[model samples]
Target: MEKDAGMVLHTLFEQTARRVPTLPALQWKADSLTYEELDRVADAVSGWLSRKGVGRGSFVGVLQERGLEMVVAILGSLKAGAAYLPLLPSWPTEQRLEILDEAGCCCLILQSAFRCESASFTGAKLELDDCRALARVEPPPAERAEVLPMDLAYLIYTSGSTGKPKGVMMHHGGTAANISRNAHLSCEEGTRCSFSNSYTFDVHVADIFKPLSVGGVVIVTRDIFRIPPVDTLSTLPSRVTRARVPRALKRIIFTGEPPTQASIVRIPSTTRVLNIFGATEFFDATLKIIDVHGCPSKLQSIGKPLGDYVPLWVMDPDSKELLQSGAVGELVVGGLQVSRGYIKRPELTSYKFFQAPWLASEKQEGGRVYRTGDLVRLCQDEEYEYLGRVEQQLKLNGHRIDCATVENKLTSIEGVSEAVVVLRDGDLERGQLVLVAYVSPSSAAVSVSSFRDGLPAHMVPTRVVGIDTWPRTSSGK
Candidate 1:
């Protein structure tokens, strides 16, 4: 293989294969596949896809839940020289079909047991158990084909909070580098990871793919995410000693809803809870590991960058100039691990990814940076303290409102909004936190005091406002 080709997925597979061939590569209930077994299965799946004309540059969808089948199908697609698109089982069947239609999937590798007749697709349908049977029937391959670093490895879709979900195109080199770096830091034998997030969330990229790629054990629990916060806290840690969470970056089991007594007792003494801070743009940046020893800092800071591939800068929000180390400004990311752009959304891509003005050298390759709509303060200790989202900081009755803080408060509010609220800053500090009109003012006649009664005092809004109309920009964001 060429030198550049050595940085992709198959290369990592070879390393894990050498280190622990008999080690458990994946485990779900009674089914467990070793590294050697997984490799052979990938080979057969690749051969099958190759026969079906799903090769390099082809798009394939893996629609399944968190199980041994999901792992095999993903590896099979990669081995077949096609990009894998993860179809989240938690999503409505129609939503999954929409993504399948948009991406133009050549084939959908799904589990026969979970297959719904309504899922629309023009591609060939392959079942997981049948594929496993095929894996046992086919002969082993001589060697896996090499893939380029810039080749598309997977197209991860964003949560469909805005109108419809969109896919983000990620290259193999960047994805491999991210997984490799995370594996070297987080995984080991008997280290069970609570693989909780849906595949669509980028959290899965690091949570599920990174650990398994390194031969670590992952517990794929199918529990619905909305089981009471206390119930989740109590039950989640029992399955895995360590878990990855999107919020609560600085502290674990504290922020969303305070863990109940039952929840606290469920935690293993050695369990390590990692509150990860990242976006789809950068896979995993800063992470704070909290365990029986207790967390070391306040509850909001996102820690620091992980591995050599990440570079962070705090800059003036308005000027786009790099701020002094201790100054508060916008957080900018420039790194090899960053995603290329949103698939088929050039106008949206241009809005987020931009030329780095702080970098004096114009010739620096990969110098283009992403302007994360976050406001942060650089501490003297060289850590980024997340102030709030720049997009959510709005003026409400002359007071600066951090939408994140409000949202956190609303998470505890009972029967107020449909539990879905978006804070729009008309201008800095002048914004409204709009509810989806599930609760009417005339019918409920709710007061600020009642809302504050449901949450911690700081989260209560200064003005309980209503809006009948909202103007949109050209992009409808």
Candidate 2:
């Protein structure tokens, strides 16, 4: 790795902090934190980690909820020159421990309020009861450790088709690229950002960093599943008079699962919602500026790639040939946004991230791109409309089935809160392909019979399991 492959993720945070010391860097509930304060506090955190022997390249587990503690832990870990691994408090204890052990984390940062299986961790704990108090501390011995851009910034785990979770290594360089590429998403000084997603998912990266990258303040919402209405973006003093939203604070960005069509219209018309799409391999490569005034025809068609910095190519999955206009093929994301690869799984890493001569520009090196399993079409308007996952196309009992279509259609039913359809491999010798549907809020009136009526008979699930909730991955399911 080059000594300065790119700018370290926290360098920009420190730069902005120095320039605007008293500017509000974050907002949690009624309390607010200044840029200078956050930086000084993170310095203290880095020093604390140094005393505990954590430094560059070490993975530190952050088991705090989305609040002051969580934000501080992330910034502090970066300042300490360590990769911050976010462990969602809601995750099962066994899964958390497995990930903790897998990453070989130096220590776990937890809030006093979080009651996790601490005994199971059996590791160093930095439990802060009042994270805000640290902002007033005196400068420490090791304020911020030196780190290379290639060094890991955070580690995110994603569930694999093979029934195991795999860790993806996101470096400082990749993170910087992601933010810089999507600068159009209202990354200005004093922009209001919402950190809604769990830190466990990489989506949190944009929510937290996009605002901080531009000296804007992030409203650290405790709510995990939803972003607050635009009116609520104000601090105590600002909301008193609602003349108009400040020009700088006009944009809100989110990924993973998108909001419903009805929910999108409810947001303030002034707010420009940027729907960002990307694979875990890259933070966010495609960003679409959705005009809330003119609602989308359908909830999909997530616009284009982020400028020329990152290239989006639709390629034939089997032949790897670049598809022309309007062709539905596997989406390939390339450019500076691509992460280093999977943490320790070389085979899986090689399988996903490969050289893409098809997408190479004169300035590009080796033309690296990540093969996203998502099926999307290059539309007539020069945007991409997500169809469904390639995995949905399964041949069972001599009938071709598209489970992705069924799942998309099934979610539209009024009573169904959420649903998951998976094609299971059972007794493959007899060509037994079992499609299982898991519906949440078990009492949800949506039934197997409805799926059969709505979907092609062959595409219908063989069994339906009504669980209280679908087993959600850190990505908020």
Candidate 3:
């Protein structure tokens, strides 16, 4: 616990770089960077950003594809004492502008390809070419900002109950705690980790930060074969079960969604399968190391809490009463991993996060707890069996889709009066999940093209069906 105190992400990377300056820090296709080189480049970015009046209490928007440049932008943002906000390239231009404006981004680090997309942005823009040129030049000596553990480390946007995206503010202390715990669990000096997740996803933090914190190598490439065999891989369950996994992969982590029995059985016996349960609001809260040959029932559980750093509780949704073992209730997470709540959303933050005096003795984030909105029952063994969500939220592929948000968008369509969104197994043989939208007024016409232009790819319903009338309960919903 003492070691976990006051730990920051960039400071940890600096420590590791000093210990292993010549070690490979990042590798993408034919290019690579040693720890010393990456540190210098990140410093250059920090200096450049400083010259542009970007520093502490600033938000740096990172809009670039996954590669060496992306990693540099992230580390450079941290080095500049600013939180990096990742904007997906696939998002609609309007959606990108909305987030950039909402976060009050002070600067944007982007590639030439996204210049037109971000032309409407009001913040100062630093292109990838600028970062490369800065790396080659000698950076001037500048005073580093005094960054604290509670300072914002990054901001990840997720679907909100309304038709907007909410930013989850993660601090350096919590991020470092999760990274240290994960690295201790699987990483060692010189271990190679595969970086496959999109930078927009929260899981990318574990994919990149976990390894770099422990003097390990991060293989940043879409093709696994392009780089040397990695020791560990973190990705969605669908990808690993459907595609051929690398034989040399020793450990595999599945998150975003639960892993099926068939998927777990597909992995080689030599590789360890760890199913992680968490959300964008928090890092990993619970983890289960799957025994591929064990009883299938074991795989149904989301395992125990991640040691004492994260505490899990079950409480009645209506009564707000704590439930004992074997009772089903909403899962509550409290610890250093709990984020600082949504950006500029006071009402939503107050509704989702609340104080818990009982947790004070545990020294958890001033006794703050986040309601996960997930229902689960505590097993006799202290593990948890995941029940369905308290709401209509769905996790398709690896992205979380809020049904209300999609429905809100649907209602905005000219002809749509009422709408409902759900997940269906469009291809049972391949175990693929598809989003379906059901709208009222059978005569109403809905076009998938319109949805494509208005919504993100994952949020677009694959099938839109018009119903004459909706079935109602006895009391009417």
Whole-model Cα lDDT of every candidate shown, in order = 0.61, 0.71, 0.81
Using alpha carbons, what is the TM-score of model 3? 0.80
The regions of model 3 sitting more than 4 angstroms off are 130-132, 138-141, 160-163, 223-228, 357-364, 392-477
1 versus 3: better TM-score goes to: 3
For every candidate in turn, the CA RMSD to the true structure comes to 7.7, 6.1, 11.0
Cα lDDT tens digits for candidate 2, 198-268? 67667777777767877888888855233443222312111111123333435545466543333354456
**Tens-place lDDT digits, model 3, residues 334-439:** 8788899999999999878988645656554558899988878999898998755677768898997767557656655665656789998899999999999997
* Residue 217 displacement in candidate 3 (angstroms): 0.6
lDDT of 3: 0.81
Pick out the ten consecutive residues of candidate 2 with the lowest summed lDDT. 234-243
